[model samples]
Target: MLQGAGVVSLSGISTGAYATGIEPFRQVVTRYAIRPNPAAPWPAGLRLRIAVLTDIHACDPWMSLERIAGIVAATNALQADLVVLVGDFMVGQRYVTRIIPAAEWAPVLGGLAAPLGVHAVLGNHDWWEDPDALRRGGGPTASGTELTRNGIRVLSNEAVPLATRAGPVWLAGLEDQLALLPVRRRTGRGRLGLHDLAATLKAVPDGAPMILLAHEPDIFAQVPARVALTLSGHTHGGQVRLFGWSPVVPSRYPGRYAYGHVRERSDLVISGGLGLSIAPIRLGVPPEIVVVELGAEAVA
Candidate 1:
């Protein structure tokens, strides 16, 4: 099936090999004109277009600075009212020709621009692998620091309000839900995340529409109706989807939170994301830049 989709070559499949080296590098732009949802009502006249970039496990050949710059340019071309980055701006794959430092990658992402500004939330990788953050016992990962220094706002269980033509809009960025896995993995301590959803929601006053940015899609299940739309990544759409199914998903619910848009209590759009992890392989699912248009009719 993947072969028919042009994800893997015939020779590659004939050898019984699975990894498609090219799929990891290829990217597609996914756009959506959101339909009205009864569960999460859209604020009257409050329209927003969001461009989401996530799971950018920035590194050497897999996700190079040049490639990031290209993504930045591509995202900017979308002319979104807001840009939300759903984290993991750190190296994920072990085998790399060379590690690309944040200093180099940060400037590339600095190129990303939107009218509302580029906002971000840290991912599990940003917390676990950062030496400075680990050494200090908390906070300000190198990638987050550099991205902020370059004019992007990094949020950790924080919310920011934006002024739109329709009315006031709030962006709630949740910290990585799996922030303490490294310590837990290394020494059996609790892996509780620093995220405080209730506290974060407090920042949003009653009746103000909010958009939630969570790196992991699992948090979507907990998202409330006050949030009109929730954006997430980190699943990578299973990274190797075939016939619309991913065999190895990291989430506890497996396929439920694997990818694309889902609406339960709150509407959630999970980006397939721009990078890879664990292995340098992508099969049927390619990397992507997601653009979501809320209140699409307003623009029309």
Candidate 2:
């Protein structure tokens, strides 16, 4: 399942146990360029750099504040114009309260510099926890009063127009497709749906190159065709994948869409993510911050 210079594969592991340990997970960081070609055409003169970090179950000590901070600092030094976080900000009940604590983690993450700023979306894990609480710390505030306080933008079923030197890039962040419930029954919620995605993307300016941040890559099946690229990272790239294969992958999507960059008619990039999930151990796929550059094709 290898495509071009990239590797594509499916996973068999579904549990959250194999995602522990700093040594194993630290290697998951990968870098790539997503420049536009004939098939994928962005604005000719506009070249934008995008950095992506996802599925960081920040509760794990391996992916400790120092490790996570280092990763963010490195990305900032790259001077990418935009930094995007996919999701799974927390690891359910385990690290619910400590997830991305602003007083600590934000100083490092918030220190990130990008002309367009940082943007993020919610994953099932975050939704399963206290979405209202997590939102209050980092990105968009639950009260919508601290949007600027944390220095990050959280997209949930909404589109924010980013003013770039080239003009404007319409960005949309979808609410976690997973179901939601009150505090007592948060994890008891049901599955998710893409019924709102189409309507959401349609709201964006037609013909404007659009990039979406959806925690789960499986949502691609229901997304509007106008979307150029969708960024995600819930699979941890098969956290404990052995020899490039995982015993199981916890994903709602069928087929090989559970991990990595799956190329359908459109483009999708899935980060292996920096932090751990259940057990906080990683094997093959390590944590990563992806770098993508967007532009037109080279002169032939």
lDDT winner among the candidates? 1
The stretch of ten residues in a row with the least summed lDDT in candidate 1 is 12-21
Q: Considering only N, C-alpha and C atoms within 3 Å, which residue pairs clash in candidate 1?
A: none
- Residue by residue across 59-128, what tens digits does model 1's lDDT show? 8888988899899989999899999899998888897877788888888888888889999999988887
Residue 73 accuracy (lDDT) in model 2: 73
Query: Candidate 1, which segments miss by more than 4 Å at Cα?
Result: 1-19, 39-41, 297-300
Question: Pairing residues by index, what is the TM-score of model 1?
Answer: 0.91
- Alpha-carbon RMSD to native, per candidate: 3.9, 8.0
Give the alpha carbon lDDT tens digit for every residue of 1-300 in model 2: 256324322232332334332344454346655554345435667877888887666554455677777887788888888988777655543633455543455455667779898887767666555566443323243322232356777776778888988778888888766534343254444433322586668668877878888887777877655676788888877767667677778676634765665666677877777777766467767667787666633223
